[model samples]
Target: MVKVLLLITSAVLIILSLLQSGKSEGFTGAFSGSKGLDLFSNSKERGAEKVISNLTLVTGVLYFALVIIAILGQ
Candidate 1:
């Protein structure tokens, strides 16, 4: 039960975190003609990025809490 929820949350966090774009470090975009982009320019994540990011953070916190509880309970 709780373990299932923990695994699901972990998977969701991993997926959501992967959906985010990296900062590019000012090199990839500079030479790849990918400027003026919110991750690649021309298109955005439709605001779901924030939601997913927040949820990922929350899930991460919950995962840690669950781990602590399980460890302490044993």
Candidate 2:
């Protein structure tokens, strides 16, 4: 059961990570100091991005906990 859960958590983590928006542009923008770039934009996550971000965090914590549990269970 633990193995099955670990597999599912990993798959979900991959999918969620893929769904998130890239932050690399911000790094480049910071170095370039682009006029239109909002490198430190104050805009809040307002929709799917917000949900996905929260879900990713929760799943990440859960994944970590599960890994510990599996290791200790053995």
Off by over 4 Å in 1: 26-46
Q: Report the lDDT tens digits of candidate 2 across residue range 8-70.
A: 999999999999987555666667866446558775786999999999999999999999999
> Which candidate number would show the highest lDDT if scored against the true structure?
2
At residue 11, give the lDDT of candidate 1. 86
Best by TM-score: 2
Total clashing pairs for each candidate: 1, 0
User: Compared to the true structure, candidate 2 yields what TM-score?
Assistant: 0.74
For each candidate, give its TM-score against the true structure: 0.59, 0.74
Candidate 2: stretches off by over 4 Å: 26-43
